[model samples]
Target: RGSLDLNLETLSGNLIAQNHSFHVLEKISFELPRVELCPEVLKRAKSFVLADPIFGKPGPIDVLIGNSLFPQLLTNERHSLGANMPSALGTIFGYVIAGTAPCLSTAPRASNLAISLLSTTDTDLHSSLQRFWVQEELPVYDKKSEGELACDKLFETSHTRDSQGRYVVRLPFVDNLAYAKLGTSRPIAAHRFESVERRIHARNSSPLKALYIDFMDEYEALGHMKKPPHLNLSAPHYFLPHHGVVKEHSSTTKLRVVFDASSKTSSGLSLNDVLLTGPKLQNNICDILLHFRLKNLVFSCDIRQMYRQIKIHPDDQRFQLILWRGQPSLPLSTYQLTTVTYGMNCSPYLAIKTLQQLAQDEGSNFPQAAHILKHHSYVDDLIAGASTEAEALELQQQLIELLRLGGFELRKWVSNCPKLLQQLPASHQEPPVFLQPSSDPMFSILGIHWSPVTDCFKYNLNFTSDAPTKRKVLSLIARIYDPCGFLS
Candidate 1:
């Protein structure tokens, strides 16, 4: 109704008339009083035709047929119902009642129906251009929420370095509300552990069960988790339910244990529910990729067990307990996670903040490495490069030394330059399968496939033969994974 470019449907069929033009109204506003008619009047008519099936019911009008199009729709025939009732006019489209019908109710009625219309084209070109630019402009990052601000302040004031040089941070809880409201989680944890145990013991799952045991054994051997000294069943503690996630393609670790911190307790509150997710600290992924592409020589690596490398404060370790047993014949033992866990709500923030803090503290000695850490790194992955071979080697050395100061080991090192790969220890370098000459080996750089030999990003898209629906097309598009706009 606001613009002349319109398509409409009616009770009979689609209104297909076209090419007719009329003067556009700058503005129009009106009010229509409610009308009621006796049902008997239509019943007594010789012939009946309804333009709208439920015209008697009060409802909002979708469109108004103005005088400009009324003539085209007329058939020049009419039928009279009665003296008080409206006459039915025949049109090529359908029959429409033209005159008003007498109100059946004797009581007075007031009209609240109002309609307003303004031409969209009335706006000047300058105003329209301004609106277009406003929409096209990049969105400004929103101000941090109160909880985020509090988390930042807490980390800054409380985070400290441990004897092993690893950074230790307290959990960012939403005040003390989470601790006060926490209920017994042992029963839930026990139930979940039993379920996982049953799955591992299922027929033909011997390999999976052994892998799970080895993962948990390595977890304890590395001191990421430890048995509590004293038993306190009544204490406010959480038991994280954990499960194994197997990635057959992984080079170093095939199976990894993922803890579930979001499991609800008896009070219906989970550890994640009470935790505050701190503000994002990582550089924009697009910016990182652009910086990565600028240099001729590029290399990528990730921190080994990045989250587990950072210790959680002793006071907050109680909230990260878990139930584990090597065999189904043994009873479940409670173990506390001493490090920042993978599934915690604030783990990402704590890990990134710790990295930033390391750079800030030691950047004076390693300026180039510090800059790469701040600007070129995304989460735990470092995708950075240099213009020359000498500069690339220097950067690699400095990054390794700087990260070592914080007890963070960078592994899975891959680069386009074979000389650079030779410099890294065999254990630290990525598997030789990625560097094999016979095959076009591909490496995953933050979910995007990258070919080191050609120094080009590659996509592995698998499309289904399903019908091309809106959802299916979007799903296919999402699989492209071209965050750097290489296709654009």
Candidate 2:
């Protein structure tokens, strides 16, 4: 029928009528399958007529209702069909059996199914707001696990300062016997080194190869990596496989050699597997950003090679060995990483713990800087400020001096006040162009972009013209990166 008013009766003897006239399909050419209801379900739903009049026998479809009429047909009441069986739903037209049922005959038959769509914008918005609140809120203190407590105990008991003022710490092993489980790793390390060399040589230009060599050479020159005096292949040692990573956007080193401590030894155990990953010691990013916004003269700086600043104990250096050769013609040599390597599980904890220890030891000389280091730093990046320009300058000086006491150098300094930055050495500050007011310089604070000239945050949204699917929509939403909820 083109348009009609329909009335339906329920098993409860309630009469329901359509709110308004609605159009319906007059004839459906296809045959609908017969749905056999369970005898027990029918007994429980006594005197209730099936939603479909000819539910138990195959028949040609007479009328079809669209999704717009679902609200009038459906109800919240439901009757379960028991385990592993379809359930019957309470609708205005009586009880409707839903879900899969066995086929009555060997021949295939079509089944009658209704699909309904509802708008979920309100539900999605509510969920999004909840996630935003949880992420932007301050982090709560969590109790340390047994492994973390053990790591802390090891650091407190064995850490010491060298003549150069660098903090030397031992690796936090699971137990005293953890190192004994390690097997020979030199063969695997050699294979991985060959693979890396082949990849670099296959590049179109030789610059990549040269860059890789230069990076390893610098690592050696800085005293971070050294050739072991004695070769003891029988000793319990772990060798890390290394590869090069290129970042063209970086202003300093373009190629960085990354050591893979997760590489397993012959005994099927990795260095990371035996070491205890210490508890997270850095302040949360939300807290750091909140304090950054509280001051009039804000600035940002980060430790240069932060992990390499802390020295590892000599006894643990054998576990951080690597294979390197400047060229294919040169003989391969074994080198031990003396500093806290980045790929190890305990590196972050050791570096951060060292910083806190330094602050506690010398905080009395520079209280403001000490507080900032302890509370305003997120990992290696420092985001702090003061109420005035003079206060900011003094804080900056104190921070530089205090960090120097532990042999930690800060670089990439940027600020809203030009005069404060002017006091810093040209080599120590970020590019001079970032301070020019005519050219608004935007740098990343964590992942969000901020413009020093305008003193405001910026967002670059790159949306695609592709059709909006569930996955694509979610991906686009994730790229927003507004941790501070500035858009809200």
> What TM-score would each prediction reach against the true structure?
0.69, 0.70
Give the Å error, residue 155, model 2: 0.4
Q: Give me the runs in candidate 2 sitting further than 4 Å from their true place.
A: 1-140, 203-205, 432-439, 465-474
TM-score of 2: 0.70
Question: lDDT of model 1 at residue 353?
Answer: 93
* lDDT, candidate 1, 393-430, per-residue tens: 99999999999999999999989988889987899887
- Taking the tens digit of each residue's C-alpha lDDT, what string does model 2 give over 359-410? 9989999999999889889888889998998999999999999999999999
What is candidate 2's CA lDDT for residue 484? 68
True-structure RMSD for candidate 2: 19.6
lDDT of model 2, residue 353: 92
